[model samples]
Structure formats: C-alpha cells, structure tokens
Target: MARHSFQSAMATQAGNGHVLGYTVWNHFFRPETDELHPMGITQLNRLVRRSWREPLQLYVETAHDLRFDPGAPADYAKDRDELDARRMQAISTYLSVVANRNDVNLFVHDPPRAGMSSDEAWRGDKDMVHGAPRGYLTAEAIAKGAISSEAPGGFPITLQPDLGGAGMAFPQPPNFGGDIPVGDFGGDFGGEFDVPPGF
Candidate 1:
C-alpha cells in the first residue's frame, strides 16, 4: 500500500510540470525486511525515467542519527546505529547507479558521535530526538550548503519561469492520443493525485 501510494503521487508530481525538486531523508527502511523500501529506489526511478529530460533536482540526505523509534529504549542505540550504516550503504548504491546525474545531489551528514566526547552531543529537548535543536540546525546547515554550491556540470536552479513580465507558462500536458485503459495500474494504489501523509 505504501509503495503504491508513493508511486501515484510521484507520477502526479512529475506530470504537474511545476515541481522542480525536493529533499528526502533516508528513513524509509523496513525493519522486518531489513531493506530500503521501494519508495525511494523503485518509485523514484519511475519518476526520474519519465522526466529524464526535465529539470528536476533531488537532494538525498544521509541517515540522520538523531531520529529514532520513540518506543525503543536506549539500549537499542547500537542496533540503530548499525541499521543507519546499512541504510547509508544502500542509499549510496542507488545514487551511484540509478539516480547518478547532475540533478541528483547527495549530502553526507556527520554521525551523532562525530565531534562529541560524551553523550552530551545527543542531548536536546525532552521528548525529542538526539541533538534536539542543535542537531537539526546542523542538518539545516548541510542542506543549505548543498543547495548553495553549484552542482557538477552546473544545472541552474530554476523553480519556475519569470512571471512578472508575462503570464506564467505552465507546461502543456503530454499528448497521449485517444487511447484509454480501464483496469488496475498493476499496483495497489489507483489514483494519481491522492495526497501523501505530508504535503
């Protein structure tokens, strides 16, 4: 269900012709299967291929150690770290092979223990993940850096065309001819515009 929902939204986003780019945190792992879910690797592939010629920028983030399952106890810290490592490896592989392009940017963040001599580095507000306020600030810094620097081969970051002088030029819908099919999309999800969890 999750995979299908993701696919439908991705198709809509690419076809909408206004969205240029977005960021994704590496937290789509399924503990039971111990693999990065198809949301990023598979569904994203579909979008990238469909819009291969479009100017779409994707920023893939490394696993942030601060986020965790709130129910898990502190004793699971080591296990979570190991999982993050594995998730990073999988993300790296996908970036190198599938999403390797000037449009796709990968940012590597420092681990929670990078500059800390003790657990104080992870300290933050109660009921929050590690590094609470400060750790998130570090993430924001990295993201800003990635966006500020020029991408290899230098693709200009244009969210939308100029609208002040003339009316905004929305992309024309693809001419799919008159053919239409009635059936499942060969996936669980059916609609193309169902909103995902977060906007």
Candidate 2:
C-alpha cells in the first residue's frame, strides 16, 4: 500500500506538469508507528542506526543518482519567516503525503541543533542540518505557503507575495473567465458608474 501510494503521488505530481527529480525531499522519516507513543532521543537514535541507512543510500545514489543540495541554511533562514515555513511544509508534505510517511524523521535528524559538545565526531554530523533541496520546490516557495494572516471575520486574506517570486498580479474568481472588471467586476455591467466622484 505504501509503495502504491508513493507511485500514485508521483503520478499525480507528474500529471500536474511537474518533473519528479529526487533531491532534498527524496528521503522519508518514518515517525512513530504506535499510537499514543512516547517521544525521546532514543527513538531517533534507533531510527538513525536502523531505518535510515538503506533508504538514504538508495536516494543519494540510484539510476538517476540525484544528490541533496548542499547550501547554507543561513541563506534560507535570512529570508522572511513565511518563506521558511512554506519550504518546511512542502518538504514535510512531500515526505508525509507524497512519500506516504508520517513524521519527517529523516529531515529532523539535525545534529547541529542537537547541542552535543564540540567534538570531531559531532561536527562531522553537521551535514544533517543541511537538508537536501527538492528540485522544483525550494525552501523559498514552501515558506510562502506556510503562513496565513487570514483576515478576520471570514474574509480572505490577500496573498502578499514576498521578495522572490512574482506576487500574484491580482486575484480573481477561480473560473476568471468573462469580463470580470475591477470594483463592479463587470458583474453589474452596463450599469451606471455611480459614487459621485468619491463623494
């Protein structure tokens, strides 16, 4: 079932004009299987020691032989928090939804923030923090989607796109066909242009 779901997700993404290049989001983190599970470092230790080796090896080197993008996390961290959030969401979704796994254990295996004492072995594990980049969806795009300062009172919060990609030119109805003009939106077409010059 897991394999089928993964295949289906790939198919769906491909059907939507996306090229599936395994990169940063190639790995999946098998979160706690049991319900009402206890949380601890021990579980992480076990997962790192056991489940990760083969899966990661296959991801890093396959027929395609895709590799994780090694960039400065500081580069992404400097961007607006929203951008960071979107990146996290996309990566997480890719692993959990697309890869059919819960808990981003693979990505979360950060040794930098692990707070271990400064040592050669610990420093070597810094690569864990430098997560790989999934080709199409970068950290920037993901961060944008994560935030929603949704306007209160059931109002749609306009998407104020940040410094990077093009902000939406302007929102319109989903169908967006016909002569949907501004203000009246052509809804009341041929109607008198009222308002008395900004009364």
**What TM-score does candidate 1 reach?**
0.27
Specify the highest-lDDT model's number.
Answer: 1
Error of 1 at 85 (Å): 2.3
For model 1, the superposed segments whose C-alpha errors exceed 4 Å read 1-27, 32-34, 46-72, 100-199
RMSD of each: 25.1, 22.0
- Tens digits of per-residue lDDT, candidate 1, 131-182, equal 1111111343444553332222232221122223221111111223324431
The true-versus-predicted C-alpha distance at residue 198 of model 1, in Å, is 39
Tens-place lDDT per residue, model 2, 32-124, is: 111111332233334435444344311111111122235755443334233334334544454455445464432211211223457856666
Candidate 2 lDDT trough over 10 residues, lowest sum: 57-66
What shift in Å separates residue 18 of candidate 1 from its native position after superposition?
Answer: 13
